[model samples]
Target: MKEKTPISLHEIEGVVVGHRDGHGFIVRDDGQPDLYLPPNEMRAVLHKDRVRARIVRHDRRGRPEARVTEILVRSETPIIGRLLYENGVWLVAPEDKRYGQDVLIPKGATGTAQPGQVVVVELTEPPALFGQPVGRIKEVLGDIDDPGMEIEIAVRKYGVPHQFSEGALAEARALPDKVRAVDRRGRVDLTDVPLVTIDGEDARDFDDAVYCEPARVGRGKGWRLLVAIADVSHYVRNGAPLDIDAYDRATSVYFPRRVIPMLPEKLSNGLCSLNPGVDRLCMVCDMLIDAKGEIHAYQFYPAVMHSHQRFTYTEVAAILQNTRGPEAQRHAALVPHLLNLHDVFRALLAAREARGAVDLETVETQIVCDEAGRILRIEPRTRNDAHRMIEEAMLAANVCAAEFIASHRHPCLYRVHERPSADKVELLREFLKALGVPLTVPDAPGPRDFQAISKATADRPDAPQIHQMLLRSMQQAMYSPHNVGHFGLAYEAYTHFTSPIRRYPDLLVHRVIKALLKDGRYHLPVLPVPGEALAKLAKRLQERGTSEAMTRSRGRPSQEVLGWEAAGLHCSANERRADEASRDVEAWLKCKYMREHLGEEFTGTVTAVTSFGLFVTLDSLYVEGLVHITELGGEYFRHDERRQELRGERTGVRYTLGSKVAVQVSRVDLDGRRIDFRLVRDDAAGEARPSGAGTGEPSARRGMAASSLRSAKRAGPKANSGKSGTGKATPARATRGAGKAAGAQSPGSGRGRRPRG
Candidate 1:
């Protein structure tokens, strides 16, 4: 074997990013600014190819320019695109469009792929200084308009591991179709308990079931709650082929019309699923709740249970609404049990409120897709009492699991949500003060402080923006071996223990709980040495989630601590990957849906104000598109970053968040996942009003002024005394670039090379 050369200090390695016009840039791995690669330098590299380069000199724009010295690795991910033969040349244009450069498929390399048909291509040779990258057709994925084609493309584009390994598939196939007698050994017999699964109407895999009944506790009214989660760990042991595959996915990816499950169908939808009338093995969190909705005591155990019924959210909601109605009469035996669950839910809700949990109501939209995978409508998903009941039950169970492990002094991955950082809290306070609704977030503010702020702005016309700002001010929750407690839920400790069939961390939690119940500690698998790939994943996990301090805590044994840290990092990174993949698929679908409504007019709310333009979300379609600042008016508009609004300098006309506007669909770029809208004026002459041209009211301006002052105070050299002027607060729009230069081009239109040093 040839000896590989060691990387030198000046020789940096990074991924190649290409542009439409054949120019490229090296996104350095060391976090330095990207190095410009002109057309000549890019001839040797394709988009996403890893290469080692050296900064030879500076470009005319004073940006660092690099020359490729070696090609380190070619991306193994297959590219999905359409095959086209033009002028005796065969080429494949990538569906993602990020590839920038097209792949050349020779006549003999075309395989069975037809012209204009979608196909997966494997790179046969990296691009050379004078040639394009060469590829061979690996698989035909059908036509572009075929059902679920978008999903197939998304999975490939995001590099989501959707296919199960052959070993995992074989293992799943060999497993019993149903729970066997041997599987019931050493498990408690709760098959007679009327536990039932409550899920969404379209739900297929039932991961959890719940049952509640009245109980006597020390001369007081109490309730016995049984939360039985599908015991996926029993079938898929640690380090097994199934476990490895599940860990690679970490969490299931849910798209509008399809789901990429963490486990094979045989496990997630069959044996491990809590289907009605079937005896399934489960890990039960049995709790005793007082009348006050406080969990007095809890225990975990392995059990076998039969689900009495599988009810949907709508069915449960209707039954709860009217106990004597036809829906309730149909299942009279389960009615009383459901009623008890509802009663316990109300108590739990009261307890939650008393605990000062951060409860903010926000609209969640669901895309309704037809059999052909075309979006029919976008509707707001409403939550009812049934949803709350199930959520509360899950929360109680999760809390108990976290407590069980903590009390036993065993390290485990916790579902952690920390409080907002100091800087974000300061910005929120300043914004609130400008709106005449000042918040007193103490040095050590809790969820209650956030709840108070939410309540004060609940009735405001700009409540959506305010709530959005509040949400942004908080940190995203992630898995961590260190328990900082969940700030949003007002829990001292919390972990995900339900739905192990879909979430890898939950399965790990179940195994830990089971081990603790058997009077032992569950040790995590020994992690392999942190190699280049694993280290990169760990870095991404740290950046996307909790800080490094939480990843590896203090006062823990070396090997045990390292094992938990690795597990936490892996789970967190994969979770983020799943979310990004799902969002990418949804964005693609939404873009496709909006392409049909081009040139149509619709009324929308200004959900975001950027220096470049306004982002309006339509009322009827729930689609959000940008109305670039140039389309705002003929006059000059200035972006006020502090106030989060765009002010037309000439007329003083302001366009802040929550402002309703009429818009016409101007353009849609499916490749870029971008939608553009043009403003539709309702006044005479159909022209937009200038800032101060026709309107004499300066109320909005005054509010903006107060907001500006608050901003200045916070940015001042001296310490802020926490005082803010009273005025109607401006809505905090989505944080996007706010200037004409920033708004001049859509991301899709921008080239790979940016003016940076």
Candidate 2:
């Protein structure tokens, strides 16, 4: 008998990504190109599953294909979805669109969840090549329109750690409600220092209190600024349950009407919160700022301080605007200190400008939610002088903390914002050139150069697009053990030390500072070795600039440095996750709100011009929707990549970024979180191209010849086909005067708009 030869299979680990159309791909952890997985192969695993796959032959597209050999790790995370039954089959459709497949529920696996009811499902059986994965309802999250349902879905959809572990809860419950005398033994007693916390009107957790006064330093007079941060490290010791929970969350996630706090309320809003009229233990950064706004000297120490008052931003802004106002008169004694703080803030602002910080003015909107968690309104959140003053003070304190640790040669997570890459600079230059804007960007541009471009284009018709492109060119800020300097703020060094109550990195900074004050070194608890797949995934995420996960270098390092590196990666990744989760909740809420105003007409500006469609933001509603190319009139529109515009092939009519037009709310897909608009008027499309120039035609009907029609078919008929009579029904004539002589409106101007006042 001939011996049977064994076939050796080469396997690699990667994450599964399921598509809405039932196909799937394996995003390799090793940074290689994604491997294609047909629908047949995807039946064996679910999206986000870490699996070991064997490489199969290449597909027709020359793409490496793979088949799942072994499921290394199931997601195990419960999915939130709505229960449905059709044709004697029970299934759960995930609320998050990223999960493409539905879970099969057995007869009794539905638990107490009824049809159309939202519930959390836990997988009971892993998927097989021919059978669907079976799951049982684990929790009932109530109806879809219940109060705070969006937030609930977001928290679960993004895998946010919402519920505190029993151990963590117990540890928090056992903590004292106030600063004890024994705990303040070695701390400086600044109880009568008259420091005060200034925050928003609705703020509950006060993490910082500030006080400033004129003082003499060296050869000149300076301001003595004291910033007292809640001493979270004192309560959450290393390796404790509370500390573990805080580390897991990394940072608090804030939604419109809710906040998933890092620490339990017992600590975040009680003992560690620097509430007014209460004595709280704190870590203080005492700085002597010269009249020029430079920190001449600084010191850090542990202290017990009492906040004399809690002032809101409105009250402080009113007092600063007019010191003799009623609000200022009400806090007569604190007025002098407030004025001193404002003076210091002015000096700091001048210094910031001198340092060449990139200051891009963006209007931030805040959602005002009612008691039932429905959005009452969304208004621009204007930053007043009081807000700026507090921010400057915090920035100064953070800089001092960073400098202190760096001087001590201690490793800690620094807030780093690296300069833009070479490719980004070239893209921005090309975009600017296409818009006929001057490219004043330097070969190696700093914040000042970008700032110049923004200032020069401030009043231009395409200023919004220009500013947006510039902003997108910059890298996101991240926490790293290495100090790469912050490009946006133009700071040499920076760290977070003021918000320890909500941020884990700030707590670590507080711990390191306290250790430095005591002439000791801070030590981190031992962390388990990260899995090979996780390390590779983290490295890939870091390289793609999508996230900073477990990205510590594999090089052998001293225990302390290794600890700091790992902590930095974890904190950075969690920060990004929190942001994604918060945005998901907001997007979902916005979609729900817009569902009510369907079919209404609203004027909007072109925020982004893509080949597929134009993304427009309504002037007064502040809601954004996509105007598909098909709805841009009965003409084939060709995308101009560099110019960021869409031009009609026949009429040569153009729709560029920042162009304003009237649009009627057409379709709202709540499941997809998408809104679509149809042009109510398109005079913003500009004039037709001359007959001889390019492929310009006088009318949509005569424009598409045999050759042109063939070319249009390649770009998708729904997108580019505009043969008027040959087309079915002529697309309803574009709402009568939709493409009439409406004049163009410049960027940031509400021209041609009839938005609500």
Candidate 3:
């Protein structure tokens, strides 16, 4: 008899991610592949709960399957869902299907929430092997279709801190409405600088103001530029109630008609805001630039500045276009200075080009909502010279800030954007080669390589598609104490220093710069945040330590370095969180808008192609929906990864990234934030029908749709009819933009810019 060896089990700790289906997975904290948990193993755990699991066996597909060993932490996040009663029992079905389990609500635990109304639930008992989780209604939010309900649900669903703590609110209330004398002590007076804020029309929190004038740089023709950012650190002290609340939120969340501010309105919109004709404390980045647009020298200092005016992008652009026009006449007193700023901007732009920074253009849309909180329309936002000017100024200031900190050997967070991974670069090269584009992508490419490709393909019909692929090939920028340089911006060092009023990292930057100015080191206070809040951050820091830049550094990371790393991770994660919440609200709004036009046909461009379907963005409405593979035609379609397209095997019809098509909206799943579209075939009948239908096609081809429907039926009614082109459960928000052009917007700037890379 042969003795069999016992299977060695691997134990892992991770957060539970539940699917709408009975199955779930453990998203391992060690950055390894997720371990699948079948319906049986998921019985005793809920979504987002921390758990330690052991790999019991590998599935037939060679995937590791795990069983729950212990529940380390039950997620305290409140669940947002609708309260329902049926079969002599009350329960709440979570709005976010990821929760997977219906929470049972006992009698009297439903509170004031009515049946079918959306409510917030707090778990009272964890799920057992054979029982559903039990919870009590914690807050009654209102009807599912009420105005602003999406925002309400999103804030809670994503755990975004929407309400200010009582102590923070009290502290804000006690602060003076105007800058006081003591607050301005030892600060350089910049009230005479004629600094003016340039922002969007609806901007409230004016975080940055700029002033520029012709000056002598070592007896050469040059310009002196001043970028004064709101000093949020002065008002929100470290570890205070306001600071704690601000840290919790990390960044302000912007929606269509609302903003969930990081700090209270008193700080975001009043005292710290550089409102026109008001004295405000600021951190100034004063730079001397010569004819070439390169910085000759720079200095940072605390300042008391008064914004001479607040100009919108449109107005500034109009004035710059024609100094004698009506728009220019209104701001005649500031015309000459504006021209100097324009000259300096041109010089800086030249420098940017010389540095070979990646500047990919993308379309950004703004949602127009009416009084009822319903979307009226979606309009493409325009960017002009004024926007670019402000962007260049902010960029220059940020670079200087990074250099200043590095010079002082300060342990502060740097905005890091590393080069693309080898795999992504290879994929991009193959894609470009498949398209027959006359360009070469090297294994180790720099910002110049990408910029060159963008320049070469600018006139192509598929330029937007190619640009999107380039953007996707790059890695997302993040905050880190270990500076690896910003690949997208082509900067050796960069840090966010312009919008402290909205971004917590910028506030930290202000503190560090202040400490450096005083010839002292800034010590991070023991944050009031929980250890769990930083668990994911710790993992990310550990991962970052393996980067090439980190390996090149000398010594073991200090406590301060680790603390800054944690802060960086927290800020980066919250930034993404805010983005997700905003996108959710937008998607919900778009779904509602599309519902009114069901069965209507519209022409659109195929933005993405996957094995399952094509994602189409309507030209007129700017709304995106999925055209499932089953609805493509009666023929089998095979996805071509290299070409980024789907091709019919029998019929020669092909749909690529830039393909144009007309589709009729078939289904709208508001709950799922999904919209399904059926292709409108071009036939003599001139009627909307699934492609290749009604023809003498083979039975196998004809039965494709039926077979897909049958499969969907077997999967259950709640199964998502179609997924995003990326194979994600939900359709991704239409590509907004990326890189410096798409970076997060400063308070007074144009469309928000994403991190350059």
Candidate 4:
């Protein structure tokens, strides 16, 4: 056989990074840490281009930045921001921040859209010494404040699309509403087997169902496990409209009050949905996982499984708890087995822990709406046994999916989170040590070490603070071709083979699995249409933006040598987008909800402490309202990042995340998508005059305030910090620390705090 050439040796021709994003192209070269583009040498590279370059002189900070020597290829397409007439000369600001400059829109170049409105403008001319690229508006998206406007803004801002092609839509509409008889020809029929879907009460699209039975192992041990995933590939063929759309999206974006689904509603909520009593096709992961939580043997096959009951998390939890409720007797026969399933879940959960899986339980909030589309509640939904049981089952299936795919030599999208770089991990360890939590092996801190640290500080009142820090220390996960094991989940190999109905990655995995089963080369997952294109644009913009952000900062330029940075950036941005969208919707609804109770007070906990203000989660309403830093108390407070707390200089009363207090709704700005909460003591909240700027500093201090607040009224820390403070792990508490010296909060940051009646 001929020797395979190293990928590094290949000359990638015609590929160029746009020096100016989505407008013109430029050459970009490879290097570590910061990839530099020489001022004049940055002529041809676009946003993302893979080109060969020669190393120039090192930067001032000792990084090997380079200039592009040649162009390899151009990225997909150009997407420009809306153009507007400024003074007399027309100018349009690029929606993408990476572009870094406004494209000069000449007079008569703009379409019907006036200035201020975001639009898609194309470049008519490349950058010249005197003039920038010229462009005209292609489509006009209204002012950013329109209803559901955030989603549209995000889509345009991130290059995500809202419309499916007429062909794709037509393709979906023509498909049958239910699984055709011929579709189940070769699948196993389990319609009468009593499989049931257990999900949140509001879950409209069910993609999974479980049914467990006790079975004897060879010697005398026993096992109980059954995980059935919607068989997407069985019904949706490769390259079909449904499959194509799903592949493009790769994952469903669940923003509050809305869902941007990978599959169309028809498939997501109807046919492909695993609704109760429906003969839905499923790709079942039938396994005999023993008490050790080890999968003894597993098989994957297409089957027709009927979900006998559609149970909500609340209902299932009640049944499992044997509560005297309607659901307890509704599924009476299944209660015992459900409890058995919970036991098996517990065993598997223990097994997962034994395997060094990092169980990070972050709080998840749900938005509740009334008939008028107003937010009635924004509760922090606790993870009941039902949710954990589902999670455990999914985790088991994902592990098996990873093993099976690798065993079959198949390429697929993996949910991978790599470990932090040695330096960053060291910095994190230093931060922990400075805060009084010492790390035994500082240099090489892995998931188990984190778990150990968490366990050690489990009982501390400062547990939430420490857990938040540890989580921030870890990288976020993303889809990848290579499965190098999930660093966060503590899995050796893992892929999302469940939830094909909502997540595009899972759908793609199904396609890959089917292809692998047929001994075919697995096709690569596509970024949904503009999805990939937008992702490429987003990545370039993010890299440049992050690099720019690094300068004039405290921490070392994030070690790009750690591939996890890219993963983290992607996930973090997605998380931010999801958050922004969710918050926007919830804020709108909450603003509407709060309109009815403007003068009423609600008990809330300080879920977060930031320089900008404190975010309070109400106890009874489950709604989160913001108390501008000015609303904390009638005193000056300094924000301590190292300790993750806000301290009052006059009162010595520090408020950190988990602090409890009562607050009256001061004001809700639906236009700005912001809610203001004043202290329970605020007497003239509505009549009070506007204050200086408020700081948005995250709680990194005041970890010990929980103990102090016991005497004072507090809400949450309501039940517990998501798994972060679980067990007995409690880090040391010192109001003062080594590395970071506390700084006074900027006067502007103390915006909302005012004396209430």
Best by TM-score: 3
Task: Supply candidate 4's per-residue lDDT for 81.
Answer: 60
TM-score of each: 0.84, 0.85, 0.90, 0.68
Residues 26-102 of candidate 3 have per-residue lDDT tens digits of 98888877888888877899888999988777754456778898999988899999999999999999998767789
The candidate that wins on lDDT is 3
Ranking by lDDT: 3, 1, 2, 4
Give, for candidate 1, the lowest lDDT window spanning 10 residues. 748-757
Model 1 ranges off by over 4 Å: 1-72, 128-131, 441-444, 526-533, 536-557, 682-686, 689-757
lDDT of 1 by residue, 497-520 (tens): 987998888999988888888888
TM-score of 1: 0.84
Model 2 C-alpha lDDT per residue in residues 224-302, reported as the tens digit of each score: 9999999899999888888888888888888776889999999988999999888999999999999999999998888
Error of 3 at 432 (Å): 0.7
Worst 10 residues of 3 by lDDT: 740-749
- Global CA lDDT computed for model 4: 0.59
Two-way TM-score contest, 1 vs 4, winner: 1
Q: Which ten residues in a row have the lowest lDDT in candidate 2?
A: 748-757
